[model samples]
Target: MADTQFSLVPKVINGGIAGIVGVTCVFPIDLVKTRLQNQQPGPNGQLMYKNFRDCLVQTFKKEKFFGMYRGSGVNLLLITPEKAIKLVGNDFFRYHLKQEGKKLSLTREMIAGSSAGACQIIVTTPMELLKIQLQDAGRTATVEGSKAAAVKPPKISATSIAMQLIKEKGITGIYKGCAATALRDITFSAIYFPLFAHLNSLGKRKEGSHEAVFYVSFISGLAAGCVASFSVNPLDVVKTRLQTLTKGSSDKTYTSWMHCFRSTLKHEGVLAFFKGAGCRIMVIAPLFGIAQTVYYVGIAEYILGIKK
Candidate 1:
């Protein structure tokens, strides 16, 4: 019975295991998303990203699989905390909440998830900023590269990007878009966790038995993924913008989150808010379901001595 729950490994170990596997699975779409979000307006201030397949093909043609995997090697940044927060912290909340005698509802899930998402932004933002530079041909994070006559990007490394942020902007540079990212996290994770919990519960209607972990897990994942995407689509765009700023730029002029958001919308449009969302929905929504559901039902179960 003890083995029927999470395995004996430390929560961090379990989270690390899940994060590495899950983030690697979804990185390509994430690459495309960063590129699309950071795209500069054309001469007429036009938007980019015609479609997913076109971007994928062109990316492979230009950068090969390497191109498509921009910032991928450094993905440990995004993966570590993301998995830790969701898998470990999220589960922790459920366990704790259960002991409180208050009814477990979607609200608990949302609160746990949102908190984790907020932490993830801090853990992930700089790496994300670097990824944007690698994905786009026209932009780079280095002083010399941004200023060169050709403006060709140097081979910016994840280590270099982290170092550069420290040198240029101090600790603040690394936390560039935290307010926005926090908001994004708060809304989306909040929605996803509770939604998933509810969905997972739906599969248990037939009996109070704990046997249907896989079905419950899948439904929970699917619901959480869909709802989260919808709730925080705009904030995700804002988070990306704040992350992709070049070094030494003055963000002082922007003043507030609304200012930056309005500026993007004014220059772009409503559709600008949803640049790569369709691809994200198609990819991330489903994968979110598969990741957690698989973890709880299949992968974690293996560790827990359950077979189903």
Candidate 2:
């Protein structure tokens, strides 16, 4: 029992560190994904940026390089706890759900992953709200025309945004799209964790190691993340739109998740649900690859002198 308790501490630390590393590495791609997902067609039915590459180029050219990292500060700050809760929580549930022989069935794994996904939404919602706000800020400017270019982008500090959200809409404002966020995350973890585990297990270096090499873990996570990311991208798009849309914006407002879904399908067509699928795959692939490798490598254990 003591050993089990001791082992759990490392999972939390490693998960947090992995999140920082992964988010930092793929934030630019994630920025592009957010923009692509949130953008709607103009009057002529032309989109702001044609594709991920176009979005990346335009953002750099217009908003400059730092523009690609608009919400990185708050994202990085909140990602630690968010990931700690997710990865650690998954492991916690998995440990508890394991059978007498320390075996976890696929069903149990999915349950554990789902539980972790649900647990993280509390942090994920507000964190994502702030992130989407900052990420979509540039697009908001473009949509508004002259007034947008004339005025400087608001210096969106986390503290300021938090204060403003609280003053205007209270804590609820920070969770604008909780339902969509939950759906996306739950589906992602349900697919990702079990798939990753199966792939990782197949590549284990030796019996009892219960750990794949860095490359194996990386590849497993990348593949699983891409598949999982693409699968739930529609939900992701809805979540992004719901979170970023201003209350009284010229664009349509989504009163609920179903409204967002039906409205998007009706107006944007089916393909709109997949606007950022490619970029999302790219972002999630590396994000999970790095995260899985980092977690499996147990670097945090060595640093913290917690290795068994």
Q: What is the lDDT of candidate 1?
A: 0.64
- Candidate 1 segments exceeding 4 Å error: 1-10, 99-102, 137-153, 204-211, 247-256, 298-308
How does model 2 score by TM-score?
0.93
Least well predicted 10-residue stretch by lDDT in candidate 2: 145-154
Query: Please, what are the lDDT tens digits per residue for candidate 2 over residues 56-87?
Result: 98778777878889999999999999988888
Candidate 1 residue 111 Cα shift, in angstroms, is: 2.7
Write model 1 residue lDDT over 45-105, tens digit each, in one string: 4434457776666566545666666677777666666666656767666665563445666
Highest TM-score scorer: 2
* Candidate No. with top lDDT: 2
Candidate lDDT (C-alpha), each: 0.64, 0.85
Which 10 consecutive residues of model 1 have the lowest summed lDDT? Answer: 139-148
Measured against the true structure, the TM-scores of the candidates, in listed sequence, are 0.80, 0.93
In candidate 2, stretches whose alpha carbon ends up further than 4 angstroms from where it belongs are: 1-6, 146-152, 206-208, 247-250
